[model samples]
Target: SQLSFINVQNRGNFRWPYDGLYQDEDGTLSGVVGGIVLSPDGLWSTSTTCTQTPNFLNAKTCPSSVGRWVRYAFNNANLAPNGEALFIYDTSNHYTIVLNLKKRLTHPDGYMMDLLTRQSYLFQFNGANSSVNLSYTGVVYDLVPGDYLIIRHNIDYIPDRVYTTSSSILAASSNTPLTAT
Candidate 1:
């Protein structure tokens, strides 16, 4: 069914996804803006470019505030590396996937790793693969996330491969495959 805006006097059952939005049942829920939602167990990334105030509601609980808002309001940048990349969660399925440039990496699918000397070059793909779509823009320095390019690497998929590059280079590669060393 197509959605059509209506002038109903009440929107009774429509509760927002966030806890503090649309209502003020909690004493401290009013007049607040901006919030960060780090999934049940998700990583928190920080960037030097972010500048904004986070909501008081989830201030202590949210792993990131301004960065989260920035990434959301404007998709995460994939074209260039930033001043900081803070990854705090560890899962078995999250991996770093990068665009294949010049056809040098060996996965036949452009599955190039930062290094080729490790036991596995693949990272765990997070649970959102089904909804992801990736695009190659010929560079990684400032890649914006939602062309649906999911870079999650699963260790289980590339079992015999090892990441030859350090985590730093891997992080950089995720932004632009050309500048990685």
Candidate 2:
């Protein structure tokens, strides 16, 4: 069986884990084109560069002015038998982010299943500094003899002032335990 996950969140004042800068078509030093940032301790950070091409079918183009794309990933380890992981961080300031999921399944008989799922999470960084840590749990299911699963991640970052609500999704295949680690 295959599995995937994606998380989109408003990341304010957070630096990219690496040093390279992202550029746009005009050659300007763009932030990020929607990619995942992993910390030294294996924690996930929401930092992405906006891109012109819509990677995910459900992703909508950000208005010309806000050229920010969502940042997240589909980790293969999350698909191992009884596999489990966490996705989270803190937004030191009040911000919002959108998380989406896309799954594809293929059967030996040429049958396929494609599905899209999404949720939003609002982070209010009440700390004195402009930093926050958000996290989530992930789990995968076992394959029934001939079954196959494919998981993808879709993320979108929206400015905090645009919306005031947030959402989240909790899914499980078998009875896998989800913890913050």
Candidate 3:
């Protein structure tokens, strides 16, 4: 038989997990440029590097002069998936979508975005309890309001560890429970 992805499997007999950073030259998820960002105050940006100002008050601040989003992503790969993957304090089981920051009380928007919008900053949820914990805590979620990610399964055809040319599923696969509620 002929194998489509020659290097799909490893000697350990486990399918190599996907890598999201392989999506582009700048190392972001597919269709999701820069991954959403959260300002120190409470504003969202398209990229980690803030271009918009977070003027929570009548304080109209300059885009660059104002506060910036903390930033977040689903994690791709690096020394250990620094800003790409989500997980339980350094575990191998990476979640589909997780925050780039860790151990902080700050969190992503709401849980509805994970299922309905597939993007955090896309939709605003009802109530003041729209926070998500990046960690496995109570209402506390691993992601913040600006966390960004798109459930793309194109890398399912990945044949090997083409780190420079391949990407992973960002834990959005149906196999594991991708949720923050």
Candidate 4:
């Protein structure tokens, strides 16, 4: 019997996790992209009807126990993922794109729009006191304000090592946990 290797592809429009600079068509430094910073602000609710799904369980659905969400919005310009008016931190020219999922403070259920790819990411935070802060936390998903995603990058200096990619379910059969730092 002959064994063959299959090239697995992503099912949905999920963004590849990587913290780096996006370049323009002319190969110009387009700045950093896909940088999420989860704040330990608010608190996770203790609702029986809700359960938090581990970051490893990417496909599993939960009862909406993950309370609070944070949103970072970017312009819908014909630019790269981390184009201008977005996250541009440090002189090292390196960053890590992470999706940290854990029990944390109150965040608003929000959305992020990728201007380059014209893709939007929806996120929800199931908290007992979770409320959307339109002014400070950007626009809410339910409001349908517009189409966009937020990748915030704020740093003075780049770290020694920037995380680019991780083992996804497609790449690795095992359930690999993908979280933000």
Candidate 5:
């Protein structure tokens, strides 16, 4: 899908099939903001751009105020090599999936690993921002050969969500082809 949104309510996982996924706005759920990629065991990542805030609300357990809030720019600069990207839960303690930019053969779809359960989930969006529309397949699919672009909007509302859309000349490559998905 070109653009999609999946509501993550009462859940700690999120996934975007073929695009960059991000939080809807600068809005925070229970005082948490932005998203981050985690290791398979929900421990660490190679990315140095992500910021961690202690004592942040755990959207999974909001109102109770438990867990840390991780922040990262949903752009190429903060792009992860290959891992699940997570955003702060919404006001109702759910997550919503949004669009993002670029994808690679090695890194095709996005996956979410529950920190508490460590259960991996594969998800897709219905392009609607409603809670009932989203669903998980309970299976991870193989990567398809195509030029998929996951474009996360350069949202500046949240200080941590600020990202640049500009591309670096040295990093820019004309070899990558954009295949219609």
Candidate 6:
């Protein structure tokens, strides 16, 4: 079978597959913006919607005031030595995706042992600015051959207000391969 990489662009008010799956009740899926689906070959894709809930009535909806990030797994064997993932946010009208290496890092105290490495990328879909390209980069960690890569997108709302967002992990390479490993 051919490796299928699912790509979803400009997800706002429309209901589409994001970050793996979608839930109508939890308005916080995929970080309130754009999301991604992956292929077996380590290729990534994204999507957007224009749907908003009653809680977000006062706030903006998809393709309007939201963006997202996706998480995928990376295998050391499949990547070049010190490989990097190049991320580009398609800012065709007023939309853009920003890349943030580490916006926030914290621990709950005793429960935490090793520091968690967080790499985040943001997608800004701004229709008013008319900007074209927004891009960023992330370095591949020293992962084992059987480990997975987690990819996510960060989004900025237009009004710059804090709201609740949600997301989920659909499928990982650890469970199933797009093709036989």
Q: Pick the candidate with the highest lDDT.
A: 5
TM-score of 5: 0.18
Model 6 misplaced regions, further than 4 Å:
1-22, 25-49, 57-69, 72-87, 91-94, 101-181
lDDT of 4 at 33: 22
Off-target runs (Cα >4 Å) in candidate 1 are: 1-32, 44-65, 69-122, 125-181
Position 7, candidate 5: lDDT: 62
In model 3, the Cα lDDT at residue 111 comes to 19
> Which ten contiguous residues of candidate 6 have the minimum total lDDT?
107-116
Candidate 1 matches the true fold with a TM-score of 0.20
Prediction 4 TM-score vs. true: 0.19
Q: How close to the true structure is residue 110 of candidate 6, measured as C-alpha lDDT?
A: 9
Full-model lDDT, candidate 1: 0.25
Question: For model 5, where is the 10-residue window of minimal lDDT?
Answer: 57-66
Q: Write the per-residue lDDT of candidate 6 for residues 1-181, one digit (tens) a residue.
A: 1222245333333221111223323334334333222111111212334332222212223332232322322222122233333233232322223222221123111010110123222222223221222232223323344433233334232222222212333332232212213
Query: Model 1: per-residue lDDT, tens digit, 1-181?
Result: 1223365432222122111212222323222233332211122223222222233222222312223221111112232222112121223333333332333322222222221111222232233331233222122222234321223332223233223233246432333222222
Clashes of 6: 55
Question: In candidate 5, which residue ranges exceed 4 Å CA deviation?
Answer: 1-92, 98-100, 108-124, 128-181
- Considering summed lDDT, which 10 consecutive residues are worst modelled in model 2? 107-116
Model 1, total clashes? 31
TM-scores vs. true structure, each candidate: 0.20, 0.17, 0.19, 0.19, 0.18, 0.20
lDDT of 2 by residue, 96-145 (tens): 22123223221111111111112222222222122222223322232233
lDDT of 3 by residue, 1-181 (tens): 1112333332111111111111112212112233222212222222243333222211111232322222232221222234432321112222233334443333342111122122332321122122331222122123346443333322223323221111323322244423434
How far out, in Å, is residue 28 in model 1? 5.2
| Model 1 per-residue lDDT at 175 | 32
Candidate 4, 1-181: lDDT as tens digits: 1222245232122133221112222211111122221211112122233233223112211121222223333222322233222222212333222222222122322123312212222222222111222112332222233322333332234333333222222342322323232
